[model samples]
Target: MANHELLKLTANQVKKGNYNKAILAIGSCEAHGLHLPEGTDTLVSYKLSCMVADRVDGLLVLPPVTVGYSGHYDTFPFTITLAYDTVIQVIYDILESVLRNGINRIFLMNGHDGNIAPIEIAARKIKEKYPDARIAALPQWWVTAGELLPPDTFEVWNGLGHGGEGETSIVYYLFPEWCEKELATCVVPDHLPDKIEIKWDFAELTNTGNTGDATKATVEKGEKMTKVLVDCVVDAIKKLDAVNWDYSSTNAASKL
Candidate 1:
């Protein structure tokens, strides 16, 4: 198999490969209940990126940004929080580096909610600076996994939550030894109304430092989730490659 990991490849190998696209995994370091490891977010996104890169030709997996903005989850033990502006700058710089390397197409695989806004801002800033640059993202694979899977896949809260069924299950599938499944717990916030967004701190939602029914997570469910998520990303990258990452319509009637 051709090595698609940029970190592992030599400079000569990268030149010979002529890679033009890259995947950047953005993740966070924070508490994920008492069961999952603090590096859960990083591990999931990075692993997913590697998987996608392995299957996609000319796609390189860049080293991940392992820490992200986690101020909302700081109430939990051992949470590393970066300032929002700092996060934006970090992402911006990474994208700039990729552009400098002659790669104009980039895909961001994000593993944490708090990094969403920063990723958006950074991507936009890079686009403004380099109009020819094409950037795509899977900002929330957790939500996408739930949507892609069958309705009956998860048992509670649709497998949504920090260290919840879906997240825990994926970890169980990817890194079972890292997960203390016996210590897994959940506290679904029933008071929070659906369809109405609540800006509650991690503390306000659950004392366990996690929400949703983690006890329902299973290795089987996790395997299904991983397959769907990987397939989703693989399909997207292949389609984007087909179009040369150009979405502009050629129709004369659509011309602005």
Candidate 2:
């Protein structure tokens, strides 16, 4: 609802200035169990970006990159994925475009876990090209959401699982129409002792295609979680904006 979306802004409005920081919300379109919608990651990323951009000064929210790498969920129907190299190139191009337009402060708010590495790789490449550019890739829902929640609020894995308590609760509060509460199901995988790691397709992990406890999710918890996450986002964006990023010719001058 706020005027944070850059796509809706006119060229004259954009040239009016004040918006120096741009956020690119990156997510994936994939199976998020039976209860959650396929566009869960994209929705969350866009919503969080809007919330942050609206609250922070000189922040503009760009349209989200809805499709991301989801090869791990190949067994699940309707899951879309891009090659690792392809994703990196896509992020690089987007960043390059924005940076060239004079928006050097960039934040890639990642909603899907699979896009994390690619976003980071792209950010590194951008830094190599533009030494004055300030870029960051934040794992918005993965790390930040769980950190905002109380330790006792959810089980160990429930707070940070695919279509689990955290995500289900978020959807319930933000978009109740999209949440299928009646069909909510849980499918936590068995833990291997000695920290042994086992990787497999979606079907191999869980028939329901969900991990953690969705049954435990409630709209009330979702409301609280959303507030905390939004506040965290606003605070983080403001703090990052205030930091000095003149590590360009200034550093070279010191050497000289």
Among all candidates shown, the one with the greatest TM-score: 1
Query: Mind giving the per-residue lDDT tens digits that candidate 2 earns over 181-248?
Result: 89888777776444575666667778787887888888887887778877877777776666653434
- TM-score of candidate 1 to 2 decimals: 0.97
Regions of candidate 1 where Cα sits further than 4 Å from its true position: 251-256
Compose the digit string of candidate 1's lDDT tens values, residues 208-234: 888888999999999999999999999
TM-score of each: 0.97, 0.90
Model 2 off-target regions past 4 Å?
Answer: 156-158, 192-197, 245-256
Question: Worst ten-residue run, lDDT, model 2?
Answer: 245-254
Q: Give lDDT: candidate 2, residue 130.
A: 94
- 231 Cα displacement, candidate 2 (Å): 1.8
Clashes of each: 0, 0
Model 1 accuracy (lDDT, Cα): 0.94
